[model samples]
Target: MPISQAAQRLPDDAVYVRPRMAHYAAVSRQIMAALENISPSVEQASVDEAYLDVSGLERLIGPPETIGRQAKHIIKNTVGLTASAGIGPNRFIAKLASEYRKPDGLMVVHPHEVQAFLDPMPISALRGIGPRTAPALRQMGLERIVDVRQTDPALLERRLGLRLAQVILNQAHGRGSDEVQLHSVRQSISKETTFEQDIVDQARLRETLLWAAQEVGRTARREGLQGRTITLKIRLENFKTFTRQRKLPAPTDDDTVLYRQAWALYRESGLAEHPVRLLGLGLSDWQQDAPSQGDLFDTPSHPSEHAQTPQRDRRTRLFQTLDGISNKFGQNAITLGLRRKT
Candidate 1:
């Protein structure tokens, strides 16, 4: 809903303020960090929700229930907030189990109890069954998960496409992927903004790109990641979008390098001649345990190349200091000014 409509429907005592995305993002990062301590195979489904696969740690630690309790306790202690956990055979059953009890609750569904647990639930409780699909399922007398399981496969396949029908049937049987993907390198971290008005000034565009690069670099650093590719996105006033990319010699989580590379890509794209309606900056091709920037070229072929190490180290220290301040206070508490080119 639009803010205006939401305000109109609000009560007289309602006090709404603008969303603080950066603050929320910081908190989400903290929560994820706490979760990582529980299991190495943690998949972040969203900012607040995640799936942890504790497949073969029974001997090393404890059962799934104990692991779930520990996870909730760790999150509460570390992030100062309560978290819900659901332990099941697979992601689908686990998601349903998580919602079975809410507001600091833990529910564990074993393999033997999967059918008993899902049969009583509504068809809508199954993932991918939205408002439209729910109505269709209900019309077909598939009001519950058990109904879906009992319904004719050919009937469902004719109604909903073969793939979707099979998926729904599979979910009804409480079958889903047990794989919990760890941090994936294919995922890109990005920031983008659409201008209130189309901007023609090159300086303003560069400033926007720099800010976005800074944000991307900060997020990557927080996640302990570095990327070898820098991508720049530009949208002209006519709504035509263009993207340009460049690969770095080594992976980096430095805003300086990001900004320089992104800016270089933008210039090479030759789209700057048009007024820009939107600008974006992204870093991809993640390297989890990348070499430090200073050490990247440490085994320099020449003595002159070795001199760059100290400067790199100094810049790294400076950025680390900036990050510390930002984390302590706020994202905008300190920022590097982008100097205008002559």
Candidate 2:
């Protein structure tokens, strides 16, 4: 659902959803080898569903059915998440097949069985056909795949636009997976704070964004990452949320960049008119970047991956200096990276 529409009707108390890319990243790497002879291409859709491409590996495993069985066993044994396998010509087919039989199911659809397999399924099985579209199709006696395929492709185009209609036709004909495009860099990094109660004040919101940006920048530094994209998201009292993003001329991990870009994106996110319960800021289009230099007079930095023993001693000396400062003054007297504000 669109954030604006959802917010208008949502209850006041719902926890925000977060995507744990790190966890899923680890899982994908771990699960990659399990899917037979395939060099898996995993896209984490959520914490749960993963999109994988397993073309042509079937021959090595004897057949698709056997490959699916072996894949399921390995995933269950290793990752601890029950997964379903979908086999088709492309990623689209694989993902749809997986969803059709979830919680440890395998679906294998050869090119020959595309229409026979799809025509009986509900229209919702097709991508981009949401609840609204399903009802619309049903109203037009086009609730199933065959109903949709039987309708003139041009006629469907008139109703849903040419690109989308053709997309539907391709899927009905058993060619569901779209083109594969590689992302060049990380899109964004964001942090959000969801308040227990809706906040009507402007001052508090600014403070929260400031804190969030600092934290986001800190993480960026830790990963040696920089991004050209900055995004701001806001959740209103009604359960609606909105997000906006901006692209920068150069990638950076600087706190100033995060603050300015996020500020601009926030203004565009449609949060101004509604009382907000949550605010999020993120950076995207990330590229690997060098770490920033610190205050030279305060601390001499050591390389993170320098010879293991030397690096350890350097870190210990740095910690000792920090401890001495804390002992003499106070915790507030010292700050670094994201530790400064949020």
Q: Name the best candidate (by TM-score).
A: 2
lDDT of 1 by residue, 170-264 (tens): 99999999988886444889988777677888888888888898899898988899998888988776566788988888888888778878888
Q: What's the C-alpha lDDT at position 104 in model 1?
A: 91
Q: What is the lDDT of residue 86 in candidate 1?
A: 91
Q: For candidate 2, lDDT tens digit of each residue in 134-188? A: 7767777897888888998777888788887888888777774444333323455
What's model 1's overall lDDT? Answer: 0.83
TM-score of decoy 2 = 0.65
- Per-model TM-score on C-alpha atoms: 0.63, 0.65
Clash counts per candidate, in order, are 0, 13
Q: Give me the runs in candidate 1 sitting further than 4 Å from their true place.
A: 1-8, 11-15, 191-210, 217-342
Off by over 4 Å in 2: 1-47, 130-136, 178-187, 196-211, 214-226, 242-250, 260-276, 285-342
Clashes of 1: 0
